[model samples]
Target: MTPETSETTQAPEGHAPSHRADGRRFRWNKVPEITVYFWVIKVLCTTVGETAADLLNEKLGMGLTGVSLLMSALLVAVLVAQFRTRAYRPGVYWLAVALISVVGTLISDNLTDNLGVPLETSTIVFAIGLAVVFAAWYRTERTLSIHHVDTRRRETFYWLAVLFTFALGTAAGDLVAERLDLGYWISAGLFALAIAAVAVAHFALGLNAVWTFWIAYILTRPLGASMGDYLSQPTADGGLGLGTVVTSVLFLAVILGLVIFLAVTRRDVIEQDRITPQVAR
Candidate 1:
């Protein structure tokens, strides 16, 4: 999610509503509030996704097909629970994100590794897939903002877009570092620079908040993937040689700590006030 303190309340018709114990009612967002913690945890989860996918595929001998099936099954179960709940649950929400990230990586891996698809081709395919998802989402919902993900259809579109983003990120990241010979660290640096530029354009140059947020969101996937590869790959492959096990464990630990903090503090929970005029005042 994009980093911000609040969300826009107005939404088109068709959102499901929730009622409190006292019979008071409101429309709630399924996503967490956009904050610094949101971005930090997002990047960490992406890193974990990259490394954990590698660990399971290479170490556990799951192969790309096995891991993809496993992760996709897990993602479906988690998303089922997520959809049933009317509001965001930190554990459930982040779990879905992490699993989706892994599944997304596996999807791209299957195309490139198992099917012998070129990284360049996979990159373009995922990019176009993402664009199509975005187009359909906007056409159906009339808005692409995460803040407006209050309806089931909107939420479905959001997750689809996210999945494509991760797939695109994996393909594009590998294309630059592994396929193009730029190396992991340099690729990471390149993505980092791109994200920084988006941030600058958003804060320093008045870029549209929604556009900037999505741009940064797309960039962070490749950034995190490159970082994960740089840290987890063998030293002979130009990495620090921490290995996937160590890297996955380390990032998972951090993600757990942060999720706990957010859950206890409810800091990242987006209350319904901002999106509902009745509660806004």
Candidate 2:
């Protein structure tokens, strides 16, 4: 999930009611508060996703298809655990994100490497898929705010959108970094600049928060992927030669440390405020 602003008390019609009959407002958000820690861990998870996928494909002797199947199964299990929860459990939520990242990478790789699909084609397809998801989500929910992800239906849409973002990011990142021959470092730089632009549009130009958040979230996937490639690919391939094993382990460690900190401190949890009901005279 993308980093989000604080939860708002207002709930659109058809959403889970925010105010109880007693007129008390209760916490309803199912995701973490939008904090710096959230972005840091998200990027780290994306980086790990790229490197770990490569690592598994190399070490496990599993073709892209096999690795994709394994990771997808794992993602399904974690998501089941996630959906079963009434609130966000840091470990379970982040595990699902990390696994989804891997599965997303594998999906793009399978399309390109296994099926001979061009990165450009995959990019277009995933982009269209994501657009359709958003359209459907909004049509059904009347709001796309992450703050409103209190119900299972909204959560389902949220994860579906996230999956498409990762797949699109993988395909687009590859298109620019490899197929277009911009190289990983340059590609990373480009995506970083794009994300910066999105931030400016949101904070300075007053773009919609939800749109900006999703845009930045999608951009980070490629940004992280490029950074991973820059670190993990061979020196001859325009990387620092850290190797996928090292990159994956390094990022995963950082993600683990951050998740532990968040879990312990509860710093990322969304707290609900009590609002007294305004009685009609």
Candidate 3:
């Protein structure tokens, strides 16, 4: 067999036997399984969330509070639907992520803009909150692996961590951009470099998966938000002046196309059988 055919033939042997029978696996759902495609679409969704929130608040004149409230309600509804489902559905999962991303950005914005909270304070607060969440999750379950998120408690922790990451990222990004005087493009570049570093540490340096995952997850928020700001803000604000509406629409289209492709191909299905703890007997 050709090398390609040999690799293809080996793929089936890697899956757990249980997956072959029932197709229900103990893997991440409500989100795309981690792949390059997953990260690309995640960044796109975050960009949409950032720009869409801005459009709703600025162009539509909804104001920050109004847009925040609207998106918060939508996020809660989608999350409820997500929790209700037993299996991962791409449509439901991505919608939840997108909505939560918007709400998360709004939470940070509200603190900084409306409540007069310092970005530093917000960043520290979110970091503490995220640490508490991980502590509680690990203490209760004795594991933080995403592959084992088959129970309600684990899933709740998963979403909570996600929310905190966005909030934390928003604060950190703004801190670097506004307080530290890094321009939008520079901020984006810094965050991109940080994410690359995390990937290197994870794959090359024997870093813990959980730590690597959360670090990269938090970084993506700022990376995406900075890119969104670069594309949508006025020239005076250092952006290209595409406007939030156009930026949001463009990213949303890409997200929709990708989600549809994943749904149809099932390329991200988690293989539950591989998750079984090996016995040393």
Which has the greatest lDDT?
2
How do the residues 158-236 of candidate 2 rate in per-residue lDDT, one tens digit apiece? 9999999999999988888776788887888899999999999999999999999999989999999989989999999
lDDT by residue for model 3 over 22-108, one digit each (tens)?
A: 333233333446888789988987888789878888876788998888889999999899987756778998899899889999999
lDDT: worst 10-residue window of model 1: 1-10
Model 3 residue 198 distance off true place after TM-score fit, in angstroms: 0.8
TM-score of each: 0.87, 0.88, 0.87
Among these predictions, the greatest TM-score belongs to: 2
The positional error of residue 102 in candidate 3, measured at the CA in angstroms, is 0.3
**2 or 3, greater by lDDT:** 2
Error of 2 at 182 (Å): 2.3
Global Cα lDDT for candidate 1 = 0.82
Q: Note the Cα lDDT for every prediction shown.
A: 0.82, 0.84, 0.81
lDDT of 1 at 9: 34
Task: Write the candidate numbers in order of decreasing lDDT.
Answer: 2, 1, 3
The per-residue C-alpha lDDT of model 2 at residue 248 equals: 94
